[model samples]
Target chain A: MENENLIEVNHLTKVFASRGVMSKGQIKAVDDVSFSMPQEKPTILTLAGESGSGKTTIARLILGFIKPTSGKILYQGRDIWKMTKDEWVRYRKEVQAVFQDPYGAFNPLHKVDRVLTIPIRKFKLANSEEEATDLISEALGVVGLKTDEVLGKYPHQLSGGQRQRIMLARAFLLKPKLIVADEPVSMIDASLRASILNVMLDLKSKFSISFLYITHDLSTARYVSDNIIVMYLGSIMEMGPVDKVLVKPLHPYVKLLIDSVPVPDPERRWKNRIELPRIEITSQSLQTRGCKFYPRCSQRMEKCSKERPDLANVEEDRWVACHLYQ
Target chain B: MPDTLLDVRNLIAYYMTPTAPVRAVDNVSFNVTEKEILGIAGESGCGKSTLAYSILRLLKPPGYIRGGEVLFKGSDLLKIEEEELRRIRWKHISYIPQSSMNALNPVMRIEEQIGDAIINHEKISKGELRKRIEDLLVSVGLSPSVAHMYPHELSGGMRQRVVIAMAMALDPELIIADEPTTALDVVVQRGILQLLRDIRSKLKASVIMITHDMAAQAQIVDRLAIMYAGKIVEIGDANDLFNDPLHPYSRALISAIPSISEKKKLKGVPGFPPDLRSPPPGCRFYPRCPHRIPGKCNVDEPRLIEVKNDRLVACHLYR
Candidate 1:
């Protein structure tokens, strides 16, 4: 049978040995996380979490930038790590990534046009110079960037929004099946975020390209993604359809994450103040056998510290990892 | 008014470059009432931070105050001597610079950092200072044991609380926090914003919060000022500004923010902000404004005029 999934992550885990002077234990950066993106339908899957939650580690693992400690990342039924050299090139082409800082992605010495041109030449997408020029203009036009305005400019010469759009244009040139966007708009201005997000929506509908959108901003994630996975301390806290999970969060961690987002409306200010626990930055804190969020969870139980709850399906189209559900 | 704590009048701060003076804070005017959180909201490089630096007289080389009067408690901070200004800095007006969580000395313990701020202004005994440091840390929602740890030992949220503790070490009547919650996580950001609210209510100290996050401004600020191209385009009550913004730019800015509560199509302001060195002849926002008049908005610059009850806007449409 043909695999209907575009990518499948099976029990992904990554451990980083502490090299700092203050801490001296292994840190489970990503702990047995698993998810899949469908190949038939294009969907935007958002990996939502705070820093140190291992959302970026999963993104890097899928991109083949790092090796997982004990897990497998299967792209179209083939194990990525076990793939041949030809398969690796095809995997790299099919999976593209757009990082947070657009300025850092480009070399300052080269013109911005080189970013789009190099991708097409490397992927062998075009034959003649004329075809390459046409491909470059087409990609830029898709992302709403004009050729004359951005072609000859250096990275600093273009505004932040323009440079980010150029990055999107470069990603579009590959015609990839999946794009992993890590905090694409967090570095740009608030007023310009909507336009970039709109371009993402356009690409999804017009080009049928899926996105692995990783962000801590739930507001933008809600605006775009069809599904979301809430991670905390390298473990999956909640996973479901975006509206179902965000509207009525199941896990305590997901609920706290949603509540903490400041609403733009002034009439509905936060009613209650939450006092955070004193976060300890030691390796000992990371070695908890039970729930990692037990220290800060408001709905902690006696059993929570003794046993860790697995991500179990508690409702239709929703999975939550909490002792309350289990 | 008698309650006006900070009165900034036509403040013009520029960066002196080789080509021309970059008008960072251009002809800006506003008033911060006592015991109210005044928010200055704008995108990056719109000169909100420069305005804060100008108020504190903290501008460095290449940054000159061409003309302005920062009248705090009926005295112009601009005309004050350096020695006199130093005296008023921590004891009367304190500042939490942008990314101040990283501003702490890495080697020093948390208590010593708080102690340094206290000892600089007042001569206190070591025993008394230690007691004060613990109290400050507890007030910002940190444990007393955090005082013994270095800056690196603390998380980003804890370090931010430590910075808040230091700012409150002197109990200044006014605190200006520039993007205090910018780099923090959402949960930590909410905690920091709540701490700021607690500071305003418990201490009755006025706050001037400068940030680009409109949602954070809505959560904390009582009065809001929307900045664009180094000018105050609109200033009004936070409720009124969110409900019904007067200026087009303010409306665009308020609408630009994406919210989970409402499912609305997000619209970004089209064009980039004009260069400060040579801004447009008429309005700086005329290029991207959807309601720009053909010949009028591009010809005459509009001054900030009171449009409604306590609502001021600088737009030809308002006129």
Candidate 2:
């Protein structure tokens, strides 16, 4: 995996058994998902889906927050969960996460600077107080923040964009090789959304870092992602180069997602409106017969309801799980 | 006669706080005509929500309309009595809040909640209300059985439809939906937009759809108003707004949306929105405007003047 790819996730399947007394079932959050990221090259890989589509579950598995019931998450040819206590600590220093809420990440009582400096103090990467300050300042600069304005301010004092930038600064201060950003700009103002995304793009070029950006927004995914994976009902529907996947969709789910978005085109309207029921999307009751998307899929076939489709190599650099393409 | 259902003239409303007056809405004016869908686009603190709240008469405490007039169906609502305005609220003008689904009471049954709206606005019995609720659910692509369930039992899209159904209970002349479909997915967003359009055309009611997404607005809105720092800088027909945006702010917002139709780099608008408590000396957008005429735009604020035909632009370049 280390030869060219930075991480290789092979046959990744996550299963969660109900722990509470009332519930008893095996929930397959991510089922047989496989993909790899190249080394020395940083690119955005979008894991797009609606709720219960296993997008967040995949992110959790990659970060080692939850272990996959059956599979291997290879980070530089080493199993992420197989790491020892010391090794796990070292890995934590290399991988950081930017959550959805910027303000929610920190304590209400603490100042913004304290939140930014926590990892530095806990990891003990830099000795002495002065050395830690220098490292913190450097990280803040990378995310394009002013130490003067943000240092003494609390989460309430700073705007949504400022708080988000601080979160990025903390991630950078770890000097992590990869950052798993989950809905970083979803909560911010639309005007400030691009600024947050631009910082992620800037960091990739400046530090040779890789990003596993998890989002539901197709527009932002199109603008930043080099490669993308579309997930639906705990399964990978499609994965390929962003340009090919978006421009020439091989799966029906991906096509519907692309067409559903009103593209600001005054002349064109999607005449073929696919009707979707409210209850059909409830993930808790999603029991697959053949394909997970068969219920609402417009181009669904009779064969789709009887046999589960397998991800096949359709063409160069494109993988699809739809029977139509297979 | 402009055929306008609701007309707002220099609406200057603000929250009269003890520390300082929060100038939420400042001399903003727009119109929503019969069978029209007027979209108000802006960022979070751009007075978009304040304007919507003011229209609904839902403002509480220190918030008060300092000046200006709100003309709805030839009646000056700003000067109306509480009882008279209450009658007009749901029967003539109804508000579909941003999170109107969540705003629904959880304890009560679905039909009963809508029944309250129907009962408050119009004289209707339980049998009539139940039929109206069923018909409302059917119109929004939901099963009539949903009215028997609680809020938690129904899905988010279904809950949103319920809110819309309640808003449509009185067969109001106007429906004000603020970020109605924003919380849902793309597919559901399209469905909800279609539902709003269907309600507007079929019921012959005007719709005021306020949102932040420009692409989403192009789907259904007949006209658009771009607000910034408590001021409407641009207003025009939806097609004109997208095709020939005279204002720099409007152009930046339209360009920011990465759509399938266009492949150009979506250039983000630079600089933060001006602080409303103590705003800048001149133009609110001058600091960020890429085409700002340095001296003129920086020193004096521009007026919302008719630039070309039905298009209105509040920029020195247009003036």
For each prediction, how big is the interface RMSD?
0.9, 2.0
- How does each model score on lDDT? 0.92, 0.84
Superposed model 2: Cα runs more than 4 Å off: A16-26, A127-133, A278-285, B125-127, B260-263, B293-295
State residue B59's C-alpha deviation in candidate 2, in Å.
Answer: 0.8
TM-score of 1: 0.98
Q: Please provide, for model 2 over B84-151, each residue's C-alpha lDDT reduced to its tens digit, 9 standing for 90 to 100.
A: 99988889888899888788899999988988888876777778778888888888888888888889
How close to the true structure is residue B194 of candidate 2, measured as C-alpha lDDT? 86
- Deviation of model 1 at A301, angstroms: 1.7
Residue B294 CA displacement from its true place in model 1, Å: 1.6
Give the residue spans of candidate 1 off by over 4 A.
Answer: A279-281
Docking class of 2: medium
Residue lDDT tens for model 1, A231-297: 9989999999998888999898899999999999889899998987665645575537788888778
Interface RMSD of 1: 0.9
